[model samples]
Each structure stands twice: as structure tokens, then as C-alpha cells.
Target: MADTFAAIATPLGEGGVGIVRVSGPGSLNIMKVVFKECPDKVEPRHVYYGHALDASGNVIDEMICIYMRAPHTFTGEDVVEFQAHGSNVSLRLIVMSAISAGARIADPGEFTKLAFLNGKLDLSQAEAVIDLIKARSEKPLSIASDQLNGSLGQEIVAIRNNIKDVLAQMAVNIDFPDEDIEQVSCDEFITELKRQNDRLQSLIKSSEFGKIAREGIKIALVGRTNVGKSSLLNGLLGENRAIVTDIPGTTRDTIEESSSIGGYPIVVVDTAGIRDTDDVIEQIGIERSKNEIEEADLVVMVADGSTELAAEDFEIAEHVANKKVMLVINKEDLGMTAAQSDIDKLKSIIGCDTGDIVYTSVKTVKGIGKVRDAIERNLARGFIKSDGGNIVTNERHKDALVRAKAALVHGIELLEMREPLEVAEIEVHDSFQILGEIIGETASEEILDTVFSKFCLGK
Candidate 1:
């Protein structure tokens, strides 16, 4: 018998209502003790209005409670939920009352863990529940929801079934050596292994875009002082998020803000201008700016279009030479003094011939849309389309796929070398188990603990 567990499902704060959840065989009995006006036989899946009483039979709060019977509940157990006024004291007392009525407080993620153990959800879908909760944007939320609907699991199961068919062919060859059957030749074996490997490679490729969608892209604005970096940041965000002024080092520290562009989340960072500065604080800010450039997914090099290119501008370009860079020539409204020739000169100086160069005026907001489009185009290039396809967004899934691919490659090599069938079978079986780990069929206890530990209590 499973132990009964209770927890406050909602966030702990003032709200219109709060929910206290209990799940296990003893849930109904606990409800009978704490709730008044309870019928001797309560109907499942129905809400009953009642007063929650303490251990001493004193009314604690008027509440609405619902009871869900076994096999249909989230944890596949008898479940009860108390909806009471959103008061910390009241919710705590209710939880205490349930505990006194023979329920124990649930551990973090215990509810979802129970659902996984009882076969209500696979490990992938259970993991998706947490992703859905922590998603910061629509794309991530949509991806997580799709995974929860079993897209990724279905794909993995299909791949496993195909591998199983190949294994069965090998088994038949081993068991019926003298029988006249269509034997799996070395070429056919390699072909089948390569086919499944290609599918794994496709899924691995999708992970890159899935990661970007789950975690927004980070873009750093790098340039010399007083080049409208702050202005550009404000313009991109469509609001004044950074201080803009004529002072060279007004922004001595990096300012980060998030916004959505073309349905993709992006973290825009405005860094201090890269130039010679004697001030200690400005030096630290410049160092931090260099670090941000190193870590940024994309670097937008802002240049002043109103003035001729200076030595400092060339120096800044050289710093971000090897990074994924987009050159932005700001202040175009003031009559562009820096022309295409200047851009070519800077590109040559930076040793980067390929980059998106957009002319914009933060003051007039001209050509800002073009700059944004360049960013979206660069980020979305070669990214897999998210249209109800199985996309692996989790690092664990990627690692497992990598191992599985390696095993398949090894198996194919063995077949090509004319090694004994048993040796090749070993590698193929290893690949099968590796793939199973992704959907939790072969996952160990430690992996499950590590995964569910990231979830919050009562998930």
C-alpha cells in the first residue's frame, strides 16, 4: 500500500483561493475526519461544500472539497482537494488537520513521481510537466505541451521497435542456422543500422533549436563609447530600459532585458562602450563587456554612422572578430558619413568577411525593423521547424542520443569488418538500451532522482 501524502498545491501567498491536495488510499478517510456535513458515502469526482475542522473538531475555515477515486486521479490513487480562502494560516492549519487525520506531508515532486510510478505518465511526459510550468514564453510552452502529449516518446518507441525488428532477424539467423530463410546479409545489416542512425541524427539536430526555444537567445551590444548602444537597446525593446545620454561611460555596467522577436525570446544586453578608460569602475565594466561578448550567442557591433571610423572602432571590431557578429551603423538620420567603403574597411580590419550590416538611426528609428529581421534570420537559420514534431530539448536526451549513435556506428563497423554476428549483436543491444533510457525504460534510480529533484513540491 502507498503512503498517503498531502501538500499545498498552489503558491504560498495571498490569493483568491488556495488548494490543499491529498493522495493515497487513506485520502477519503482523512477527508471524513476533517470535513463536516460529509455524507456516509460520498460520490467520486464531485465537489462538496463543507467546513474544515481541526483535530479538536473546531471549525478552521469554510471550504469546497472534491474527491476523485482511484485509477482516474493524477496519482492513480484516491485523491482529495480542499479549496479554501487564500490565507497562509488557514492553509497551514488545514494541512496540519490532514496530518492529524493520518496523512504525511509530501516531498518535493512526490505527486508527479507517484504518477510516474503508477504508470499514469512516462518519464518524458512527467518531465514535460515541469517544463510547462517553468516556460517563460509561448514557444517553450508550446514545445513542452507537445512533448507532454507524447510526441517525443512516440518517436523513440518507433525507433526502438525498428531496432527490435533487426534484433529479431539476427536472433532467427542464430537459432535456425540450418533452415532455409532469408538471411540478413552484412550489407542489409549496415543499411538498417544506418537508417536508424539517421533518425537519431535528425532528432539530435532538432535539439539545437529546441534549446534555443526553451532558453532564449542572448545578444550582446558591443561598440565604442557614445555610439547609441543604449539608444538601440531602448529602440529594440520599444521602451526606455537603459539610460541614454551624451556622457561616454553613462552605462558602466551591462543592462539585460528580455523581449520576443518573431515569436522567439531574446535577451538583449547593453554593455559599456569598448574604449581606453582610466576610471577603475569603467575598466571593470569594460572587462565585463568583453566577457559578455565571449558568452553572447550573437554579437551586434554598433558603429557611429555620423562620424568617420576611428582607431577605437577598428579595435572594437577586432575584439569580436571570431564571434557571430552583426554590424549596426547607427545615426543614419544625421546624414551617413560612414559609407559602404567604411563597412568594407572595418570588415577587413576585423578579418570577418561575412556579417549582416544594417544602417539605422535610433533617433528616427529608421531601418530598426531591418536590423531586427537580420537577427531573426540569423537565429532561425538551419533551425528545425516546430510543427508537432519530436524535438529533444533536454540535455539528458541529447547525451543518450549521442551514446546511442556511437553504439550504432560501432555496430555498423563490426558488420562491415565481417565480425561474428554475436559481436555485432552486442553493440546493437547496447544501442537499444541507450535509446530506452531516453523514455525512462532503462533509466536508473539515480537518474530518476536527479530529474525529479528539479521539480517543485506538489507538482
Candidate 2:
């Protein structure tokens, strides 16, 4: 790039160290101009201790600076970094000095974008950079690492190559029109396309769990007041995140947190207990609880085993009947006072079976492990049908796969209908182009902007 770009590389805050980074063709000039006492001779990828100087040669901050030459740096361009004391003020001033010399502020994800543009990473791998930054759990982090290491990209490339081979065979039939060659090629194309089609179907199927692993599942804990919803939340999280009390409306607002369970990221929302109440705030909370139930992927219906199901309980059950649900009968330590008929009837209302039920006592923490196991089991059902690695986690990648898969299906259908090889070649070419979009081979500027916009500044 003609213009050098600078930014506060590390997050702005008080820490052990903060870095101001510069990248592009003019990166060295910014370093030489802003870093006072910089040696006449600069070494690529070598650290030098110095002070940042403004236009007047006034010292702004003391720091260790490093410069790396083009083609071997993160952005495949000359890069410089000023590692100073962790203060936003100092980092900003250093960046300002760099800008005054020959640099401008870098945009969000600009560095990674440069890497992608310079052949250092593909589009899917570039996306994983943001995913790695935002991951809150090990599952997503591992998935991101795999993707960044080219797990998904390699798989996509291999599939693209197979499709290319099939297209090459089709080209021979299209040009020659030899009856025997056409027949042989048609049989070969159907066989190979069926294999690739099955792979595409598996990836699309695995995308369900991949979405959960990447974005985390939103679970809403719903039940009538005094049914131990808060207790169950605290138990599930293994911390006193929610304030549990004997008071009817102690938790009058939703409490949300991120955690990991069963190799998946989970966003558990402890919404206020669902109940009909005259209290204005309680009514508002109850309304929010209803909304959470509607939005949640899994509706956890916690019921008290010591008390009979109330009208509100029946109403809550009916509301979540259309969602994926798990029934937790808490307070088992209090003895089974709530009748079997009532519990079974509640399960019937929610359309869940005996296997979906778990009994727990938040006091003694009895059956809490079973509750977690139950949740994991619920998430695991029909989720993994393959080795489980290389699952498609990005929606963009999945969408591309879907479109490519559709084109392949259409081509196969045409061949089966004894259509001309010319017509089938068009579908095959469409499939190739669609697959290329996943790796930015045919991606438009708009697609790149949308993908990189999700990143934080100075990434």
C-alpha cells in the first residue's frame, strides 16, 4: 500500500505493556521519524529500545521498538511495533506521532485483511481470526484454531479439486461427443458426484452443532415463582450467579452468563420466574421470561417436586411445548410430595418424555451432575454423525457449500435425464464458481467488507 497505517495494537487500558503498530510500504519511515535515538542502521525483525518523538523531537514515551521487513511480516508488508508502558495515552501519542510522520490509523481487521490479500490466509481462515478472539469457551477456541490452521479451508479445497476433476472429464465428452466415452464418463461422473454430494450433505448436517459450538446455545430457564429456577441456575453454573432467596420475586430480572458444557459454548439466561403478579416490575420480568422462552434454543422447564402444579405452571408448559425442552423436577430432598400423575401431566403438556426428565435437589446438590449430563445428552442427540472435526462453523461457508451442493445435484439430475453434456457442463461450472466464493476466489468487495467488519480495531 502507498500509505502506511498505524494503530494501538493491543487493547487500550492499563496493562503490563501496550503496543502501537504500523504496517505498509512507509512503515519504516514512521518508525525512523517517531522513534528518537533509533540507530542509523535498522535491522529487520530486531528489537531496539528508544523514545517516541514528535515533530519537534520531543520525547513522548520510552519503549522497545521492533521492525520486520515485507513478505515475512504478519501483513506481508513492512511492520513496526512500539512496545511501551500499558497506558492508552502513551499508545495514542505514539500512534499520533507515527501518523504525523507517514501513517494513518488502521481500520478494524485491516491487518488480517492484508494477510488474506497477500496469500497468507484464505477467507475462511481469516474469519477464524475473529472467532478465536471472541471465543469464550474451549470448544469454540479449538474449532477456531482448527479453522485457522486450514482444517476447513483444506477440506473445501480438496472438494473443489474433486469437482474440477469431474468437470475435466465432462469437458472431454462435451468436445468429442464419442458415444462410448460419453457413457463411461457419465457413469464415472455420477459415482464421483454421489460421493461429493454425500460429503456436502454431512457438512450441512453437522452445521447445526457447529453453529451451537461457534455462537453458543441460548437456554432460558422457565417456571413459575418459587419453583427453584434460580436454584437450578446456580447449580448448573456451579456458582452463586443468581441471588436465590425464599422471597417470591427475588430474581426479578434476567441474569445471563457464558460457560462451557459438553464441548459446546452455552449462554444460559436465568430469566425471572414466570407468574401472574400485580407488582409492576415482576409483571415486566414475567413478560421478558416469555420472550426468552420463545427465543431460546432449549427451554429448561424446572418444576418443584414438593408442590402441586399451579395454573401458571400449566401455562408455562404450554408456551414452551413447541420448543426443544428438558424437564427438571427440583427439591427432591423435600420428598416426593408432588404426585406422579401431576409430573407426568406436566411432561405431557410440554410434549417431553421420561428420558428428558431429571430430578435434582439444589440444597444437597443431588442429581445436579445428572442435570448437566441430561443437558449434554440433549445437545448431543443426532448432532455428530462423523469424526466431528472439520465441521462447518461459519454461516458463510455453510451457505456456499449449500449452493454448490445444489448445483451438483442439478447437474446429476440432468445427466440422469440424458441431457446434453453441454447443459450439464454449465451446471458444473456454476458449482465450481459457487465453491470458489467460499475461499474468496470469486468473492465480491461487499462480501469481504461484511466478513471483516465483524473484527475489532487493530486486529
Off by over 4 Å in 1: 347-355, 363-370, 382-388
**For residues 1-459, what per-residue lDDT tens digits would candidate 2 score against the true structure?**
356798888887899899888999998878889889788899998889978886667898889999999999989999998899998887888888888897888998899999999999999999999888888787788888999998888887888899999888777777777555644558778889888888888888878878887788898998878778887788878888988888888889888887777767888998898777889988888788788888898888988887776777788888899999999998888887888888888889898879899887866565778888888888777343347557778899899889989999999999888898889878878888888888888889999999989887788
Which residue pairs show backbone clashes in model 2? none
Worst 10 residues of 1 by lDDT: 380-389
Query: Quick one: how many clashes does candidate 2 have?
Result: 0
Give the lDDT of residue 272 in candidate 2. 91
TM-score for each predicted model, relative to the true structure: 0.92, 0.89
Q: State the lDDT at 231 in candidate 1.
A: 88
For candidate 1, the per-residue lDDT at 117 reads 87
Candidate 1: what lDDT? 0.87
Q: Total clashing residue pairs per candidate? A: 0, 0
Candidate 1 global TM-score: 0.92
lDDT measured at residue 212 in model 1 versus the true structure, 0 to 100: 80
List, residue by residue over 316-402, the lDDT tens digit for candidate 1: 988898887888888888888976787888877656436477777766555668778878777766343645567788999999999
